[model samples]
Target: MGGSGAGGTNTGKRPNGQLGSWFLRSGWSKGELARQVNRRARQMGAHHISTDTSRVRRWLDGEQPREPIPRILSELFSERLGAVVAVEELGLRSAHQSPSVSGVDLPWAGPQTVALISEFSRSDLMLARRGFLGTSLALAAGPALVEPMQRWLVPTSAGGQEQPEDEPVATPSRASRLSGPELDLLESTTAMFRLWDAQCGGGLRRKAVVGQLHEVTDLLQEPQPEATSRRLFRCAAELAELAGWMSYDVGLQPNAQKYFVLALHAAKEAGDKPLGSYILSSMSRQMIHLGRPDDALELIHLAQYGSRDCATPRTQAMLYAMEARAYANMGQPSKTKRAVRMAEDTFSDAGVDGEVEPDWIRFFSEAELNGENAHSYRDLAYVAGRSPAYASLAEPVMRRAVDLFAEDTDHQRSYALNLIGLATVHLLKREPEQSTALAEKALKVAESVRSERVNTRLRKTLDTAARDFGDVAGVVDLTERLTAQLPESAEAV
Candidate 1:
């Protein structure tokens, strides 16, 4: 995709050790970096730019690439490194980097947190207008989050821990405060947004979610009564977390990571350790989806350990399930099974009614756990040099997940995933007839949802079906339909 055409002038000819270090850590060859940058540039509508490996060499040799190139490379590496890598972090010293794109780092406990949420939400709106979802810039992951997570675990700020709901936090300013009833409305609105996200998918309501989240950030700048303030932060945390999930659904990894951090900060402000832990687990899920299970383990372990005293048993179960997913992705079946067992044991200890807890985690029921378990087994089944036993093991679990997931709009994505998973299981068993038929049903269900995650799984299943049953009429029909109708790039951003 690179061209040997006219481009930015090389600013220097010195050895750029900084860029070299990052290029090495990026796990990309020079040509690959050029290719990925070109693709990312095309996504941003810079169609004329055709960068090649020679240009990359010049960059590594301390040549300052022109405008947009620095920014593009920053976005690419940010996602690749699973951290918010600024241009400077990449040894890119171009003066053209936009301040809006570069200012991703935010303080954890301060007024600036409010500022970031406001600016981030507006920028999200701008990105939507530019044919992008959530954020295409300013995302961070893993090590970039270490300090913030540490802050969350042992907060230094006063009134940072759980307090009586009605108790006013120390040094409450006399700024205009939002009413408790008004905050209640905000909370209810957030719940409604969550339902819409699950039913219709993330792309449908991102702008609205970002807008409401921005409004909440504005409210946070002013002082409210203790109860109202905690409620406001709780609402903001929920909305921000939803925004992050929606971003993830659309395959915008950077956007998701940025919003997840915002949500975690808000959760901490609300003295909600459980919610903070949930946000960390969400970040871990993103890492797993992006195939960085090492990073996933780091986040999952942090979530499990940091919230040990505060997280409910169901929450613990969710964290352990995330742990299992990471290990399964690494093809470590033993550790994966151990984590799943721990998840099951902890979940069982949640008391038959699931121990009255936060509304957000109510979905971690038998069906959800079964879905996670099936996913672990499915991952193991596909691992290199694995035996067929895992494939057979996943079938019943996948079937149960399909049966348990309600046939309603609310559980549309999960239902479709189960169908696809079962189809994959059949494909692995070499049963083309059943696999293709089930895949057809999944394709129909997925057509109604707008999740790239769902699309990614469907693509993988179809690819397997094509490879294993290319001659089967049903597989041919399914493949034809998918090829003709869907062109979504399923790779995680």
Candidate 2:
């Protein structure tokens, strides 16, 4: 119990109970415990917990904790008890799980879903850290809702029809200036996010920054003059596309797909056909991730038609490469090779004049070509695994890719994966020392990024090592630890 104050007046008796018992065991005073609990609670916006002795006494006396307070209690008590003390044990069952919102699940969803998704997305950082297993995306909210709508807007009816050769593009120069704080803010934020995306990954940044997207969209919707407004609209369209990309990074596929569609709509409204095509390409990439290669192929073809002349050569090359990857995924070797050839041509053409190229296209270089080919070969190698024939392309392509993306900014994950891929190939080819060396390099790189994707792929390489190199004691133990730390996606990949 808390004793008298400085003047010897009775401050208040600390209630004797669970919080007190834990505090005694931990040798922390009520004031100290309260300070820590309140600090963490304030960070999470649950301000009900007070540092006052009376309230801490009530908790110690076995009084039930309220929402969020229980979580704080759990944290405080866990430290006291020298082990985890669940909120349920503290009589705060209400705080067992994080709060859930219904509608904000989708960025491009209607008001309700948007709010729900935003809330959930924001909470994911803490939830993930706490090891709370999230529910899988509900089946009803799958691609069914948006796919039909997408097909309707970009109907296949005129899919084969080409725009006239005489079609002219409207180019707005400095004379047609765009002026506004919103545009400036959008540009500033976009560049900042892009830089962060390369370093820490889109996953790490998306959860925190996506909330600002709504405000940006709102600003773009405000009334403005025609020319400036068009520019604002285009900027908004790009923002939406970026929002979609970030969504995919955090494993929210359906929500991301919806944002891509919304970006496409915004691009069309801004009369930016090339931007719309880019969004479609992004959507196709998501489709490939979802194992819908057929859909991905069709979307890439649509992008090719829509962006034939409007898009820069670099974007065209990227689309072709992605399409080739899709074909490789589908086991269509002939089409895959053909698409690869087209990708080469597009990249060569795009490299002709650096002066006219966009900043976004600068990453599309010879090194990037090596990286893309490596990924393509990896896809092919996976498909060939189920067949009788052994793979030949995976090792060489991965080797080239690792060399190419070595110096590329924020590509540490890819470099690690390429090394892992090389290791996997070496294991397949019965070169144990070579395989282990490459795997070690991959593990070092994986430690640098908070990427489950990199970790997961590395796990596959390690698992193979375990199976084939188990005879060696050192190899066996290393593989065991790597296998133990493997994430869920590791098995799937």
At residue 470, candidate 2 shows an lDDT of: 77
- As a TM-score, model 1 comes out at 0.82
lDDT of each: 0.76, 0.58
Candidate 1 lDDT by residue in tens digits, 170-196: 546465456557766888888888888
**Candidate closest to the true structure, highest lDDT:** 1
- For every model shown, what is its TM-score relative to the native structure? 0.82, 0.63
Candidate topping TM-score = 1
Clashing pairs in 2: 17-60, 103-112, 103-113, 104-113, 104-114, 104-115, 104-116, 104-117, 105-117
Write candidate 2's Cα lDDT for 399-477 as tens digits: 7778876777666655776777777667666777888888877777766655555675677677767777878775676
